[model samples]
Target: MSTILFDKIIFGPVHSRRLGVSLGVNLLPTDGKLCSFNCIYCECGLNEERRTRSKLPTRVEVKEALVQKLAYMQSEGIAPDVITFAGNGEPTMHPEFGGIIDDTINTRNQFFPQAKIAVLSNSTMLHKEEVFQALNKIEDNILKLDSVLDSRIRQLNAPNSSSFNFDSLLKQLCRFNGKLIIQTMFLRGEINGEHIDNTSESEIKGWVNALKQIRPKQVMIYTIDRETPVKNLKKVSGEDLEIIAEVARKEGFDVTVSA
Candidate 1:
């Protein structure tokens, strides 16, 4: 099984396909994976394959790192478009996620006031009051909603929870009330002898209805951009993405397509 890890508390000034030049903050373990879902197309690879022994950064450590990194960037006259929360796993899984976001906001204000704070979550932890409140405070609160069908969601995200269902997740996501960005990963693949393709007509139709009900401020559709754990997976073409974008547009949502 193939797997990858961030190996750092704070990493990157890398170009984000959707968010532009952004800095990454990893609140999960620096050396291992700790996510609620084991996505087949995750660029970081399989969850069970994670092998790093590093631990999650403390709130203070994260705060200090942000201050130092931001201070240096400011001193050098460099500015990042966004400070994104994503790494090896679920950032909201961190015990002090709320406090860390608070620290990050303060540090960003002190050093890079122009930068926006963004968090990319799997949407599973929104049930936690602290996670919901913290996400509500951020400029970009991106939540993953990979498919509309519960069966498809099970095959795609491979949620750790046995009770994870599409309807319940959609209801939880609706709590954001159009304030969130819905991120969908488009791809075709198979796992455990089951052929999976979330870009199909039925899948797209289901996704459209879900987006309408959620009333997300924006929708992000993207395909696998890096080596995935499941090598059988196929990336959806750019032309095909435009076709999907039209469906989202007709559904009355701003769309961003990343091929």
Candidate 2:
């Protein structure tokens, strides 16, 4: 079995195909993960056993650890392209998310003033005032919207409950005023006997409509490149990714493809 890449508060300045060398900060616990969506493609594996009230690292803990690691990296003349809030699970799920963002910004500026702070969020908590505020403060607020169709979204993302609505969620995302970077994962597969494919014409049309309404600054289109928890998942080819990128660009949205 392959070991998990990110299982701690400060894990990497690992080379990312999209974000370049990123120093990761995981707000979720080292032992187990916590997230709103148990995505089939999540590298962290499915949230099988919930530890909802587990002790997440405090803001001070994150700040101190990150500051120490960052200081060491700087002294060694190693600079990361971005300090990312992405690891075992959703960073926004942390109770002190806002404070942690503030602390990261302050500390990172003191060290590598040039590195950007990015957060990879599932967009489920965008309705929360604190989550919205914290996301707005980050340099790269990359949010996920796999598909706009409610049925497909529920099937693909496997969100925690029935209360998750994609339409209303898009409306909330539109309020961001183009400050967000929307990311969509393109994949084709069978999950539990259901044909799980987002590359269909109808599905892409719905996604395009949602992108038009949200008007995000950029759209990062990519497919699975790692071992997914769910078997039988097919990776979208680079050619198909380019085609999707072209479709988004024609709609006047900035698009980047990572196949």
Candidate 2 lDDT over 31-53, as tens digits, reads 77788998888877788843434
lDDT, candidate 1, 143-168, per-residue tens: 99999888888888999999988878
* Stretches > 4 Å off in candidate 2: 1-5, 49-54
Q: List TM-score per model, in order.
A: 0.97, 0.96
Those runs of model 1 whose alpha carbons end farther than 4 Å from true positions after fitting are 1-3
Error of 1 at 175 (Å): 0.4
**What pairs collide in candidate 1?**
none
Q: Give each model's clash number.
A: 0, 0
**Model 1 C-alpha lDDT versus the unseen true structure:** 0.89
